[model samples]
Target chain A: MTPRRSERSGPTMHDVARSAGVSQATVSLVLNDVEGSRVSAETRARVLAAVAQLGYRVNSAAKSLREGHSRLLGFIGDNVASTPFAGEIIEGAQDRAWADGHLMLIVNTGGDRDLEERGIDSLLSRQVDGIVYAAMYHRRLKVPAALREVPTVVLNAETEDGSLPAVVPDEYAGGRAATRHLIDHGHERIAFININTLESGLPAVVERERGFVDAIEDAGLKLDRTLVKRGDGDAETAYRHAARLLDRKRRPTAIFCANDRTAWGAYQAAADLGLRIPDDVSVIGFDNQTLIAAHLRPGLTTMALPFAEMGRRGVARLLAGGSGAGVDAVECPLVERGSVGDR
Target chain B: MTPRRSERSGPTMHDVARSAGVSQATVSLVLNDVEGSRVSAETRARVLAAVAQLGYRVNSAAKSLREGHSRLLGFIGDNVASTPFAGEIIEGAQDRAWADGHLMLIVNTGGDRDLEERGIDSLLSRQVDGIVYAAMYHRRLKVPAALREVPTVVLNAETEDGSLPAVVPDEYAGGRAATRHLIDHGHERIAFININTLESGLPAVVERERGFVDAIEDAGLKLDRTLVKRGDGDAETAYRHAARLLDRKRRPTAIFCANDRTAWGAYQAAADLGLRIPDDVSVIGFDNQTLIAAHLRPGLTTMALPFAEMGRRGVARLLAGGSGAGVDAVECPLVERGSVGDR
Candidate 1:
């Protein structure tokens, strides 16, 4: 537990104080810039000059002890820091934290309960000002008991007990927006390619489906039950469903894919069947993952999840002392590209 | 500068010591399990029982002060923590650090020089045991002056001065491997879609191209300059180049794409030309980005960048006192899928 010197051996505060001809206490007060201190401006200047000359940097550990806060926020997520879409959540939170003069201490647990517990302990031991507990996808989870002792906000997820503040994408609104966009394009017969809830009971699946039905009914269009198909939210499954739907005797003029990956499969189905996009069939997608949506032959028009916004909001909530014990649904904006056209 | 109480008050160390009928110092030694401490087993048991009953957590700041080292590794990267491929580097470094009883303190700079300087200052001030300076891609960079004060290892990058230890992908070896895979498939007439160094003078571009030429010549095939085309390392540009090659009178039976995104474009071109993958024309790609590679109709056969491995190696070097200097070229293993077939 002994203090080890850095390899390069930078000048210490004591050396700076000695050079400035001031007591170490005066140097500490001048360097920390403590408010309402009785030190004269000349003394402060002398200490500052000595610090610059000696290249003396404040020891953050000692500073943290004196301030009682580390000016650091802990961000713990389950498989969010490394994944494609979820990584944006970390970026959003980090940017927001940095803007507030706080740096994020990130720990990605990849959904290991043991690691998650250890990560929480590590963050708590480090005395992070607050914690942002996040999930890769929108879902309900039970947070660890240790988090109750710290100011905590959940991102892209909600506490099962609903005792903590949370921010998640407005899946219902996103679904409504996607359907309404297709309707505005003059498409009456719109088929829905939904994520299979049986395989993954995600809240997004049920909420988005509800929004789709509500939009169709609101538009005075007859909702055909047979027009809706459920897939495993993957390309191969969506391809088979799209191929069948497009080949039907009474084919829908448009298809609303649950996600970008699903839309990718639909694109291939239309391509293989010699059906031109927007001209022969209009398609819309959700989760505008730029990697796929932007690069498709004709760019895909899809709904963009507010991952970054959710992250920012989560950190903001923590900074505000983790107030408001309820789930806050952020709006998902529609990103229009080359995929949609007049039906 | 005063210590602020957490929202939910937790039992402090003093409270545990009081309940255990022991001095605070005895509790500290028992809890920290300091090596060769003179605490009897009975006293340790009593202290642990009190800790469990009171739910007391150690103050990490105080522990860090006692131990000289924070037991934390600082990871400062230029847009690596939130990107697709680069995020893996963080994961690799984090996993390795955790295995050695260290947690990574990650800071993503997004290539802002000011932020990079501030991030390094923050890490140094916090007294991180070491640092991992990383770049989003393989390239050479000048590290900050502050980095000299600590043990630093560059990940997926190298220092301009070559004074710090670094780990980057073996771009030349990857390129050679990609070409050899195609040649092994009995491809005589092969073409290469290379990254345009005019737009991005990345190390991968030059090294990979060299490896491609070397592999072709080593296989006793006639090197054709006309077969090599350059693009912006994107799907659209690669699409145009691939379409032209496919339409030529003496088209190549196989093509090697510099990256997966470029290969995705080539896939579309071949499909549009009614050429089935691996059946009619073969294709290979570099940087096996699973988001594209695994989801493509037929999985892509490509070279996988050793991003995660580089991260692990970088952290390992830092843990080993950052002893080695010069660059360590990690091998990019070939991931064989359904893309390549016999010509």
Candidate 2:
């Protein structure tokens, strides 16, 4: 009998009850807390001791299924396969979620309708408390209809009609601050270079471009059409655009890049044209991507998008049930480096 | 009858069955796939049509509890919360996992015992099929004992005792290749600068140092201890360490950095001392970190560790149910840039 007992695996509720001299129902009541029937403290302690000694384990999956909520939150990124920016957002969201006793279930949607819809369905089926839809940029988005029923927050992007609650940087302020910084340093004849995207619509891009133009107008500087170029949101495009600007008879004293990558392209074009930074043509960029800005020859002077902060606050808002109708914006600050100098 | 129907708000299986003209049992059979019960193609099609029309949803939590395994894989990254390198690894792992019909559950342990243990426990509770533990670097590791029961593969970190499986870059080969590149260019004297971490045991460092020493020893050249410096794995530390090396009476004709970041530090130190890259002294580094290397005055010539490939393969190995007890060393290739020049 002893040898057979040793050969048997870990004990279950039945074994615990039998050893404790109680009914299995009582043990179940004590473990599951059946409100109607209560067990004595002595009996409960004995059952617990037997269970501990026998190494009884509760099946978490069974418990979760019964509880209806899995204590899991999901994050669906539009396209994390291309950019490192979304990674910071994930880190921020994960950190906050982990601290609150929840695990983050993440999926990269690859911007596919089927994949995005499937991801939302899976997260919902898993009974996630909330879902976070994060995009690489603030694009006018057409969210999957399935997710409309679930509690979701859009990060770094806004709703098409501004109905969904979203969190994004105050790009207009960031642009204004960068231009102001350049203007205060006694530089005029500034040009704005940007990428043409639906997200970079006449609204977002124009907001930044307008901020730059406004600063120039306010400073009483002449605004020239030849200086304002569209980079198509890429390095090669920005490089060509910057090359065209620099090759013209009268180059603008300064150029404001839409983003850091484009600014890097402008820097390369400037370098290729034998113009020195600050001395030949001052360059300013947005988004202080540390990896790029730090290593650039003179380093890039740009604004730092509050990616981590936005992610952190976005998670906080989602957890606090801050879902209603409308979008929220955050402000990004300018980071001064060597790329901008006095005229 | 129509007015009475208003009292019943929730959907029922009969409604779905009626909508598709299928029997309740057939609908259940198609939707739940009750084991051993096969439904005809016509019945399955009808059930699916009914489901789509009525927006029928299955309770995945209950199903997963019954099935004992969720279509989810867990990845525990070593401090992904603070670094970008881990981001690349995660993106690679997630993309591969997504293609294989599995969702990735990411847990950032932040290099803590309790957190690491909780991360694994959370995965187990979710009933994930396998886990991938990705560390930031290849070095000795202390994997939690509780994880031995679950199938797991380590990435970017090798086993302390080689018995555990790991996938890391071939550092020895990388070191030899870097030294050979410098040597082939007719550099007689060379120096190696590295970072100091407890996990980076003498064996791995010695392997690289041996490669550098061997390249010099084979050529009957003197290996100066004064030129060999350790950066302690940071820009400030590497800056100071390289500064000391440059201050020496007899400096090596060229210096090899242990990693790209450390190399960036060395490059800064060289610039501060007015030593032109490849003109006064040639410099080479390992780990082609694009953010750091691409922006250097002379782009860094270094080896690109196959982190993405390792990530892809690590997930694949876990999904294939391979025992986590083997080593898979990936090759690191050299990326030519302006940092290293022919002496």
Candidate 3:
């Protein structure tokens, strides 16, 4: 273990005392703000001035030990620090935590069970005021048993048994909203390129598909099961599926893709078939990943995942003594760009 | 301010002592592992078993106060947690810190000076072993004066006056490699779509452009000033520029884009003009952002910015008592996908 370097370089209380021509004990009293220090006002001012000149800072570790509060929150996530889609989650949680005068100790465990246990142990050892256990995506998970020792809230995910407060994106509502937008655009024969659910069985895949079906039926349009193709939520897979659908003689007027990457594939498929977006074939997507959606030839219209809002709400819930056992679903707003068109 | 909740719920030392049939003082002595304590080996084993059964963790705050080491590293960044391109940087730093039995306390200030100062103050008060001050993109910056009080290293950026150690990407080499790859493929007339340097004057723009010019000169090929067009590093701007170039009577066979986004624009321009990528026009880019580069129809061939490596080296430098005032440039590896084709 490396010895702490602060002791070697940081100015000590003795340095402040010498600069102020005061006793070390008196300097400590002034710096620590001891309630009943008897130092004169002028001497206290001089000591503070010396401390500032020397750039001396109070050691919060000692203060936390005395107050029984570290004023630090621990954030443990499987891949929040590494995944491109979840950086906003950390940003929101950090912003809110800072607003409350607390800092976050973050650990990205990469979904390793042993690392997760170690991360929890580290956070517990530090005496963090609370823990925000987050997932990179919306899923059901069993939180570590150790998290029960502190105020914990799940973010972007839910506890398996629904025994913990969680903040997740309103996938069903988002799906419904996405389909409704297409219907609103007068796209009757819409093809839904759904994400594959055979392997992951993600809640997002099921809820969004359900919303697509409900919206089509509500609009009095006959559901064409053949038009719905399963993709792996990737560009290549979606591209192949999109090509097959668009190549048909009688194809849907619009395609509702599972996500932005899928939308990208559909865009390529349209290009290959000499179809202009929103003019020849309208396209919509979920998870408005700005990198792809905003930059596409015709910007993709999609549902924005409320990742940042979910993160902020997660921290807020943890700070508010944690809410009752249930999931708090945040709304995923529709971001309109150039892709959606009137059919 | 909200009080810390650990005191209300966490198991106490008294609880451990009661469970082990030992005194509170004895439990503290055993848990703290005080040097030369008189506790018998049998009693120590019993106390350890009870601690394990009750999941009683040692309070690191108290331990830090006693040992003068918090075993924590502070990571301060402008937009790391919010930007898509920089998540891997955080992952690298956090992984290294954790491997050394340390946790990272992260604060993303969103480039607010006031927030930056407060973040440094918070880390100082918490007695972090060291700090890694980072920028979202590679640039020259003046680190906060408060950072002088601790061991600090800059990541993905350099100090304006070269007064601190830093790790930045080798932009020049990456640019050279990108241009050389095209030249090697027997492309003589290559148009360079460079990022606009007048606005941001980013080092990456200047360095990458220099590398492009050097490679052209080194290969004994005349540098065509007319082939270089300035772009705002966005897809729209690149599209307009690429369209004009590709529409010319005698246009360059290959286009070297400053970055992946710029390349994305070039791709669109080619598609609109009825030109196939690498078939009608060979294209290359820099900063292989996986979101764009990997998902492009023909995966984009580009030089990847060594972001994660820079982050890892930054923490490693800070841990090794920091280095002399200079910048350590890490290599940007070339990632070959399907965008580039034989000329």
Candidate 4:
């Protein structure tokens, strides 16, 4: 094949300037909103008309917008493939970015720090307007050093310094709401089944526990240390924990699980003890993981993490000139189902 | 703010040409791999050094490779958030694309037609090298008109007309493999539970069923029509279907479920009937949905859908200049667990 440039090449900025009888600098200023430009309205109109007539588009190899924006956002995640909520978060970001006529370049780090740094460098190389660093779970993390080179936001996780705007689920509220729901049902002896705090290093566990403590204290109920059991937040672990608790002489009439999996274990424990859900022991859970919560015999009443809303707000803030690196929390709505009942 | 180019602007082709003492066209030919260029090896070496010295990295908005390529691949999906394998597919594509020095622009359409069209348009406007049209499930679909404009490969789904390369799970092999696993466990009479065939319009149903039939016939076991049942592929439906089969005097020793959820339903049915899992009836399932399969009391043995492998192969095919519109099937490995027992 002959090495030749196509005759009908895409129109460049220079072509627009030439057709408009103006300098390329004038065209760039009027079109790209360069602050304090001296170009007149008539000349701007002529340049715009010429650009329209020529169907000019900034080529990927030589694009130089005066505002220095690429209209591209980088969504960097850790091990997104195996993470259940990764899709929801990406869906949220992609929908919003596309709505604003922008594109997203997604990079899943597979939880490697080197890979994450490389992802950030790649995003920078592409001149993305901003970057969103996200985690599969809600936890504290060390922000990647490369994030310092660009406007960055963290999602579903937080940085130690709180120097970047973050959008995280209100896990504390979710826990408090779960406990309160059981309390409202006239259950004075409500047990709390939680994931082990120190072992997990997950904010969800620490905040949820705090919320449980606060709610019980605020409700004028003395917190029962013996009734609070910690496990690995799995069905088998929860089953063992609940079994031991229910075997006690003064078993709680209601149970609030840190997560739906724990509630599932509680359900099994109750069944093994010849107890009926809600009828004999009311139950509530957090993070209304639909697969487990909805599939349980008596659909679990749990808290719905505001995953999509967090992504939406993150982008909205970035577009609204966000800075100052403050932490933000989104509401976790109570998803009432059939589990909790009156004592 | 003087409406002038930045002093530290990236060096352009002109700079490289000037440094190499050659025309800009010659530099472009040598660097971009334009075919049939008669440039000397020494001149090409000089241009390469100049390019390295200038640090001329291509920007996202104006990236241009030889043959008008942009080094950007579009990964367009429908309703990826709710899908179980979204992360696996994306991780495969992203890791593969990045390994080849290409970046993927992902667009999730939430199953909306207009949004899908807009996504295609957006990708085309950015001059993406090619597109990977992905679906959340394995089914036949109407190829978007915009797909006609670009080189495309469907992932996890097929177009009505085989006009594009597709990488899909071998559901037939998976089903046969599941049934064969039960047979291998010394079960002569095995029941097949599945999703509705015609109602679902999913190729998975038909293909998987075909494989089940083939395996049974190959085993010289008469295909028992009474042993085959179609349900909604939910626990409730599977429970109902399972109850009828268990009620029979000549019940099958094993059951092959369409999915892990169906296997869960079978477990419930066995429990309700006071039957021990491996002692009374062994069960095997399809689609190793970790949450359900691994969590089930006796982990449900199932076939793993090759989601990541399919995505990897799809990108590999596109990179290999795929356009034959051939459908490639990825192997679904049988994951052995405790669900199946020796009869």
Candidate 5:
């Protein structure tokens, strides 16, 4: 259901430039975030405000006319094997695009940048309206030279210098929510289990740990070193790490898992040790993978990362015309169910 | 990513038709399941055997050339909003497609046939190589007019006549496995929760129930009508249904849910009723949705539907000149976790 954009009329890029009292090229460069060019924050803000006030909309067809090919948005990501969130993001984007009468051409790059480049080239050969560099998580993004002219949005990935537009989940906030849930339930000894992965000199696991620690510290609770367990990102490793922590002399009453998959491993480990969840040891995980979390015996209480929302909004923004805007962050929501026990 | 056809020699559609002692049109009709045409059981088998022997391949590019777009495939139907199975199907198809030189231009029909037709039109206007009518479950499929000439493979869905290639989970085996697990654990008073939906008329679910009944009848166990629960294809309804069944005077020692989502709801119901899982009653669910089942407190033991494998196999079949081959079925494997318990 590709949207027919001619059905709607609104302010175009030229209109936004005119209203913002800036040149058309500057408006595009400033709004789209073309590399090697700098625009004052004040001017960029003015242009954005003008866009908002005038209800400025992007005519992907017009852009495609100028460039050739319909502005086919390219989403580069892995299949279900590597990232569970890819499907949701693609769905959200498709839904949004359908409403706007725009078509998106997605390519699964299989974790290879060269393949990603070739995919982008295919999209380019078709004269895509824009390109969306969406990954499975908030990992470091690598921008290719061929995509410079296209309006681009990086989904679930971070950009250097905040020059490229990116949309990702707020992992730190999600961790805080999980920790707060456990603390409010009268649990004093809490543990954090996370995978070890580095992204842009910072690990997603560490950031989540920081948020959990911050919550505990804010509550005046002691954070013990014995309570923190780092998994190697595999179910076996996570299960082993959790077993070691739970079988300790003074184990934490509640455990916060890095993600749903890791939480699954933790569940197996607990079951193997005959630890009843929420009674012997309560468990909470991040990223509410609907299928696994819901079907778990005592359904997993986890945070729902806005993967679909991020993909939808990112594509919406790109299609709506804000290629030059800096990264935008979406909040993750908590889905409470049966995993956590009442202390 | 779309895989380009191998420039090497391969068996053509003509080769399969010639070896099968059938007309080329007959082979296409049999494989595509054109209505108002009858393909004998023996003839269908012979064509498939010929295809297998010759190693014949369908040139998606050539097919698209005959029709007009790239040798791109289109998949309709999205269960991501409710079930996690659709993701794996797309993932499997996408991954296999990259190597086979065909790109799947997936359109999320969101479970609406009209929207599906629109998606079909969008694909056909561009001249697609073929179309794959993928359903979330194995139910009667209504062929759309737009799919008249496009080679199609129905996934988790079946037609009135078993003339088309279709891939579905082996439900009878899945049910047998679940029941066998419980029976081995010494459970006698077992209840089955079936999903009540238009598609519940699905042969797969029927086979599962048949298997369950067979196991119980074989054991000569008295089945209670009050214990059988039916969920309205949702977690909330499943919760309510499970609550009613579990609250009975003589609650079953074990329960089997139709799908993972239903199990999630049932888990919530059991928790709300203050019953400890496997202590009061053990529960098992179908469809091993890793994200949901694995993360549950007790971990859900379930049957894994081969969505990825089906998608991969479907694409492989399409490329292998099995495009018009009749009625192909794939097997679903079982995955055991902690949900099921000894009676």
Candidate 6:
């Protein structure tokens, strides 16, 4: 017969017990740091010394069984590993879970449906008390069939059905604030560069556009239909669109980019046309992607995605005995930097 | 008495037992996917059907107890989440662990020594089979006191005492390759932009410089001491250094930047002096940070850090019954893009 893993490995609790002249149970109590055990101080110290000498590691599975809870929280994400700047969600969730005396079991599915389903099963079989489903970009997602079997919350994205509890950024508020910030800087003619949301049906795009329009109309400013445009939400595409707008006979004094990368393209366009930033044309962006935003000659003024807060709140709600069916929105705060200038 | 979590949350295996008119143990056998069980097909189907009706979730701790392994690996890191482009390490480790039927319990300590200690304790209490300690930047670190108890491997960094198994990138080899690539393109008079490592004592800086010097000397090229300049490893500082080099009576035809960001600074300096990239001066960088390298107009030619490979190998070494006391260096492959040009 094949020997079990424990038998094949190095020293065990039994070895420590033999060395310390105590029962294996006593060795376990001391190694596990169990509370209120009746073992004498000297005996506990002897067992600990034996453990240190023998390098005895308590088998986690057995310990979990004895304790009745694994104290592990499952964190499942699609494409999070490949997505840049979105890692803070995992960090925040892990930090909060650790503070609450739980470990985060992270599973990056890489957007594979089969792998995602299998990941959930594995976490469940490992007995994670709850699961946090996350996405790199905010959008509606199909619910995993196995997710309902445990306490689950969605992060950065939500189910189209709205059946599961979710924590996400308030995109509309961020858009309105960005537009308002631009207006407050004495910019009347403002152009809005939007994302090509027809392909993905992302609510952020549509809602942010609505906020832009509301801000414009609320200020009694005429909505210039010709000023609004859509791009692939990439720098290259944003550059082309920005150049066209700048080359036109009439140009806006300020522009609001859907995200920071787009704003970078707009910056490139301004450079190409020999137009100085803010002096030639002011710009505001969203998502505050620091690689682009912070490093730009004049830093970008934009809204920060509440990824950390969402992760923190998601874990908090899970520990609060939530039923896994609701949506809580986190506010995106504005970061003032060199990109924005007063007219 | 207060009801157990399973009793309060939803259906229990006992509910399936009663509905199917079979023993709860039989239900567990079928649902836990236990191997070598001899339950009849009819009874197994009935138990599964009843489980679906009652939504019975299998308790993982009990299953782990029966199997005698938690099948969980702990991943502890400092500043990994906040760092740009380091998520690949976690991805590779998580993917490998999952394929081996193991879960990775991740904890980001953000360089807090006390928090690091507590995080390790938490993972151990959850019963992780082994631990993988990682860092954002490759450097020597003080090992956590709790780590010696279990099978542990260091990723992207090594312990100061050299007592732990470690997997890290071959920065020296990478520097050689980057410099060689420049020579292969028929470039002479290559200048190496070194990082300011006076205070940090970072091995990457010292080793990379050695590789650059060795490659230049092996090519029978006289090394010019004036061509070597140190920067703060930022784009701004790099730009200043690059400008000074270009302003000299004789400028090197090509430049090797300490990193992608430094290369970006070089590119900007080239533009400021009305010099076109490759046409006037070819540039190569280290660390193919896609945000800066790939997104640049010419696309940077640089070396890729073997983060994913290191993460994968670290876990594999632990499972291979390693004693956790050696360093395994992974290769840093060169990524050739548009920046390199034939002289």
Number of the top TM-score candidate: 1
Q: After superposing candidate 3 on the true structure, give the runs of residues whose Cα lies further than 4 Å from its correct spot.
A: A1-54, A198-200, B1-47, B198-200
Error of 3 at B18 (Å): 8.4
Task: Say which prediction, candidate 1 or candidate 3, comes out ahead on DockQ.
Answer: 3
Could you tell me the TM-score of candidate 3? 0.92
TM-score-sorted candidate list, best first: 1, 3, 6, 4, 2, 5
Write candidate 6's Cα lDDT for A155-265 as tens digits: 888888999899989888888999999899988889989877545678678878888999999989999988998988888889999998888878888889989888988
True lDDT of residue B291, candidate 4: 74
The two-chain DockQ for each candidate, comma-separated, is: 0.52, 0.28, 0.58, 0.33, 0.08, 0.36
Instruction: Return the top candidate by lDDT.
Output: 3
| Model 5: chain A TM-score against the true structure | 0.76
TM-scores of the candidates are 0.96, 0.79, 0.92, 0.86, 0.64, 0.89
In Å, residue A226's CA in model 4 sits off its true spot by 1.0
Model 1: TM-score, first chain: 0.94
Summarize candidate 1's per-residue lDDT along A16-75 as a digit string, tens digits.
Answer: 989999999999999877899999989999999999999898888778767678778898
- lDDT-based ranking: 3, 1, 6, 4, 2, 5
lDDT of 4 by residue, B1-343 (tens): 1112242356778888999999988987886677889999999999999888886644445435345666678899897788767889999988888877677899999888988888887786666767888998898888888676667899999888888899999998888888898889899999989877656768778888888999999999999988999988788889989988987899989998888788888988887787778889999988888877877778888899888888788888877765688899998999888888999
Model 6 TM-score (2 dp): 0.89
Model 2 residue B291 distance off true place after TM-score fit, in angstroms: 2.4
- DockQ score for candidate 2: 0.28
- Give me the candidate number with maximum DockQ: 3
The C-alpha lDDT values of all candidates are 0.87, 0.76, 0.88, 0.82, 0.72, 0.83
